[model samples]
Target chain A: MTPERGATAVAPVPSETVTRRESTSRRVTGPRPGTGWRQRLEIVVFVTPALALMATFVLWPVISAARMSFYSWRGFGPMDKFVGWRNYELVLGDDVFTGAVMHNFIIVFASLAVQLPLGLGIALLLNRKIRFRGLLRTIVFVPYVVAEVIAGVVWFQLLQPEYGVIDGLIKAVGLTPPEQGFLGTPDLTLATLFVVLTWKYLGMAVLLFMAGLQSVPDDLYEAAQIDGASWWQVQRRIAIPMLGPTIRTWMFLSMIGSLQLFDMVWVLTHGGPANATTTMATYLINQGTGRGNYGIAGAASVILFVIAFVMALVYQVFVLRRDTKEAR
Target chain B: MSRQKMRTFGGGGPLVYALAAVVVALTLGPVLYGALGGFRSNEQLARDPAGLPDPWVTSNYTNVLSNEAFWRYALNSSVIAVVTTVIAVLAGVMAAYPLARYQFKLREPLFMVFVLGLLFPAAVAIIPLFILVTRNLELGNSWWGVALPQAAFALPITVVILRPFLMALPKELEEAAMIDGASRVGVFWRIALPLSTPGLITVGVLAFVGSWNAYLLPLLLLREDMRTLPLGVADYSTEHSADTAGVLAFTSLAMIPALILFLALQKRIVNGLQGAVKG
Candidate 1:
């Protein structure tokens, strides 16, 4: 082919070569023989199964939830009974729903205030040329991978009112354990769950910050140090700004994740001690499937979905835009 | 500060060591305590909750392991996770290939839909999904009831990770195969699929772990006999609330399989996470 191309070279060969390159680029961008029905057919064949499954399972459910929110159904029956806005009205008016929304806010605020900074600090510590760095990283991140049910069970044992590990240690120090235990006390349940949440998810934020830190040029730190900036100042002035994208990404993820939290809370407290730890997700499940009130559950689902969708969209537009643009 | 910043040694200090030690202890303490506590009898646990077992017992483990319910739960979890991973990966690979290689008008928009799927947590959509699966589709209480929706949820991450990976492969290889008169499907199967193994493993491990540990979907979709490991543990706890030791033993047993998988594929999981987040 090379010899034939050379032998057939003509006066306008440069233009021909340029056109061929464009065609080649198009082929690289997509399947060859562009604008042909056959190529389109191949694309359809490749994509149909995935698109079908996603639409049927993911997309359809969300749409159906929207439709189901206006009707009263027992989750097992037809959606024949229509109650326009009553389900939403009830969900909004329900004290438990209010409490669950408050709990979700508390989690989001606490994650932002506590877990994010704590993770960054640890990432900075681990990013240092420290011994056992790999070991430390592995140990911390192990919990993120461990099943939430197990984390809940593990913490359940620790926070038991009487002879659990935490109480045992406290009693050994001559202090009394709280009367209702950590998980059972309304005063302490949300706080205790927050602590557990921090423990479970902190590793993810730390690892993310660590990845961000790797991209930071070491010479910048050196430059800051030579300018008489302290170690803390170097991090605050340079490293942090450099990690802005990562921090934002983690914050978005953390907020959305906190909103949708289920398994850990379900396993730990079942949104109990007077619904103290109920987040949007646990509330939806407990009310919907647990009580078989599909209509109200669907209403709650729409509310939850709107919250998640709006938060994500807002973050992607207002926060993530800069990071993505810079990448491009 | 009278210190030299040693990049190689991480600028070690006594304070750093102290902080690191505290973090490690805090992080691993509960897990280790729980795992070790499983070896103690209920009596011993009550007597000295803070201490090592005075008389270690293997019977707790033996009893849980030998129980038919335990195996049943474990097997159910395996089936759900494995099935979800396989289907999710297959669907993701097919979808990602075109999204990665093609420059069609709808390409970016289609990819965006999958990306947006990451935001739709199962909690927010469980009601209708439950209705659709159990009532409309009549898959209620079946393994597929859980597995199908999970695969759908798993698709977004799988596609996101695998698309970039497929894009990174050399385009010339496919062209070479095509010049030999190979069809598009032939090139995809022969060249693209084989080259995507690492990406496959990354997506596979992720989907498998996510499915294995998933709580809400299985909780809603599957019944008692179809209960996965996490469900089984939850059920066991409620039923055996009296036996703290037995609950711990059950928890320990449930933790082992996922732990083994995570430990074995720690590198891939961590790196894959970094890749997915960065992407």
Candidate 2:
């Protein structure tokens, strides 16, 4: 309901509020007059369970992580060793964590750089009246629906140095496979990871873009056609421009997802060979769970939280504001 | 318009079909390879790395299907997913109902709390969550440890989607129910719940799929025999590294439940995502 409705529902006659309150308080020893108590009970009953769960699992952990960041605890007993900002200093100084941050930024930019054009191109093609459109859409989107770990495991098997299908195909094409394989080679690991990431995520981009395309009114296309514009011209001059909000929104999602990339990397390389593919997530996991460096992990997590928060705030303020304002 | 213009604007031609075919092939190639690779023996794979099974063998699939461990993982995954979905949908519906229909002072701010939750990724809070679940709550190695947290994480999207659905319902029905002496709770149960089945189903399916495929939470909370399908798939691959065909069989089977769910309710899933993004 709207604010005005809520306001009136709470106090029907504002001028009588004091008298009503006095009368209700005076009659508290007897029966209540109206549905106010019943409504409040209903609201409390309905809202408390979710709020409890959220506070326990979601809100509490975030606060705990922030608190844990300043302590040198091994994730057990008492977290009494208050090391101040030493953990943050160590995490920032560690080359692995710094590299992880760089890798995260690389994926964030690479996803937008690569997926944008590729996804848009595919979306445009699929947007046309084509045969097997539903089937094609389903096929493209299957990878996105599949579990990331499973996809990583499948690709890991398929990327196994000599025995992997990809390597075998490369060999069959009269090209030499990498000596240590795509993922095994440190220099190629991040790039190779990006390829798999693209394969796994492009479906989502295309699906979202196609959904956005549906919102572009057909009248514009018809008008363009009436003006004797070519198909490419109509798309460039009309469809793409109309997709600005969708594109910006998708980019925002992509950036957030890329920053937190972990599942696939964890499965495929474990940020492997030479720590080439460590994401902010994998870095924290490695430090805390893998190495018992809970303090460092806590610091890294906070840094990640800040980075994601800042980037999201900046994007919303700069880019997404237009879309929301337009929606309003 | 000429035939060329019609071809350009109306139906995509042979070239478009060809491009679509290539895209489809690229998209499904790895998935098919993994699924079909299970039909070949390790020796057969060694002989022809990319070849189809000349004589399709059923042992790999049969072996994985018959394995007790595989079924154990599947059962664990199903139980966790069901628990997560039930909790998430129930809590989401309960919370969304008041936010959507009731007039309250804290409604907007409370809704914004859930909205803020959207930007809070699970990874950021995961380490502390693991500590909280294992040490503090002592829910380690238990289904609720994972299910409860998964459901908690699923709440934001669930509420975001379901709130709109509830809001769009005709307010007159609620008013009529109230006039007929039905309590708000009664109207919610009798009218709102039944009418919002589509939204409920959408959020339910999302929560289930999400819990089923979840890795980090289960990976941290569960161990050994308690592992879910994704973890099972990863561990099975590593343990059976020499058995390529068997590993493929295991991995392929691991994905089937989610794939079937997606294929069956694809339109709903797509629409749910669209609604979430639009909202």
Candidate 3:
């Protein structure tokens, strides 16, 4: 086929000759075939399994919960007549939701605070040629693929109130071990969770950033070195600038991940000590799935979804677009 | 002066080395705590959680293996994960083919549709997934419930990873097969599938690891007969006595497949990740 095309090209191949190419271009930049009923049928076949599955499984629940939000009903009883924001009224008025929202930010803020520098430190360390680098890389990537629930379970023991390994370590190191269990105290629970979350996730972040670092052109660093820039200066001006996009991606995942955090908290604290560690995900789950307030849960979800959706939109439109546009 | 000096690699600077050491230790500490410390006796565990088992009893290994539940969890996890991996790869590869090859209308839009799966948290889809599993499909409390949805969810990344490799293949070969009067199915099966080995392996490795380690979907869907490895970890830790050993044993066993998967795909992951960045 290539040879025929090659020969035809030498012989001034007719423009209308390439049937498949013409078809493809017309299909993409359309108005030629007008509307491709055949193509649409094929698409249905290709995408229907996924789309049907998602729509039935995903959108149905979404719509169900949204409808429920307007009513005052637990999952079991007859749907109460629409109260039109009464559920919102309760969510807004509830100290638990407000407190959980604060706790969510605490987790996000604390995680980013710890993960950023720590991730960079690990990445920079690994980037340097070192002994057992392969083994180290394998080890670092371990936690990332492990089930988040197992991570919670493992860390809980380490942080248990009595005879827990982490508590033991704290006393061993002469740190004032709290009288109440680490997770039992509302004040300490969020902080302890923040630390644990950071430890578990920072490995993946470091791996990503290290991959970003490897992409920074060697010549830029060579030029920086020739300019007699110190190590700190080289990192600041060249490495960080080149790594800007990756850092932004990391920040986005961290935000969304933190927003959706339930596996760890559910397994570890279950929003204990007056719901101090409760997050939006946990709160929604408790209401919707646990309490069977399907409607309120749906509304709460729509609220949470809206909040997450807005944040996602803002990040994509504002941070990502602006950065890429400026970079260009 | 430094460019002229080329005397030693600055990459070997002491601070850089030290930083890597500390980070590596911090990252691997928990994994080591489970793997190596599993051999130590209960007395030794309390005495020094930090120490490696010396004069290693290896009894923890024996004790864990003796638990009938341990084997059950292992077999169930493997079957579910293996089945899930097969389905995910099949669907992921099939879906990715049209996006990769056909340049059809809505191609980019369709590809983006797949990518959206990455963003929606399990909560967003859990209710629906559960509804489908339990009420609609009558798959409630079955391993199939955990396996199928997890496969569907994993398809996006698997497809993306495969598509790039497919795009860069020699279209001449595919065309050559077609010209020999081979049908589209024939072309895809005979020509395309065999050539995409590395990409297939990479996606397969990822899918296996993903299904094996999954927790939330299983928690919401599966019950008694469908106890997965992560479920076992949760049950063992929260409900059982002397959780340290059981939890450690379970965690270590779960981690083996992941680590082995990583090792098998290490080169591809490194390459694939870098390719993604450049693109």
Evaluated on chain A only, model 1 obtains a TM-score of: 0.88
Candidate 2: residue pairs that collide:
none
Q: Record all residue pairs in model 1 with backbone atoms less than 3 Å apart, i.e. clashing.
A: A129-B9, A129-B10, A130-B10
**Candidate 1 lDDT over residue span B116-188, tens digit each:** 9898887877888887888779998888889889999999989988986786677888888978888878989
Whole-model lDDT per candidate: 0.83, 0.86, 0.70
Which tens-of-lDDT digit does each residue in A4-75 have in candidate 3?
222223322222333344455445434224446654554566556655555555556666667777987765
Q: How well is each residue in A72-176 modelled by candidate 1, as lDDT tens digits?
A: 888664679999999999999999998998999899999999998899999989887777887898888878887898888889889999878888888889998
- Global CA lDDT computed for model 3: 0.70
The DockQ-based order of candidates, best leading, equals: 1, 2, 3
At residue B101, give the lDDT of candidate 3. Answer: 69
Task: RMSD for all candidates, in order, please.
Answer: 8.1, 7.8, 7.7
Query: Which of 1 and 3 is ahead in lDDT?
Result: 1
DockQ-best of 1 and 2: 1
Question: B184-238, model 3: which lDDT tens digit per residue?
Answer: 5576678778988777877787788778877777877777657887888788877
Each prediction's DockQ?
0.55, 0.47, 0.34
Worst 10 residues of 1 chain B by lDDT: B1-10
* Fraction of native Cα contacts reproduced by each candidate: 0.67, 0.67, 0.30
**Global lDDT for candidate 1?**
0.83
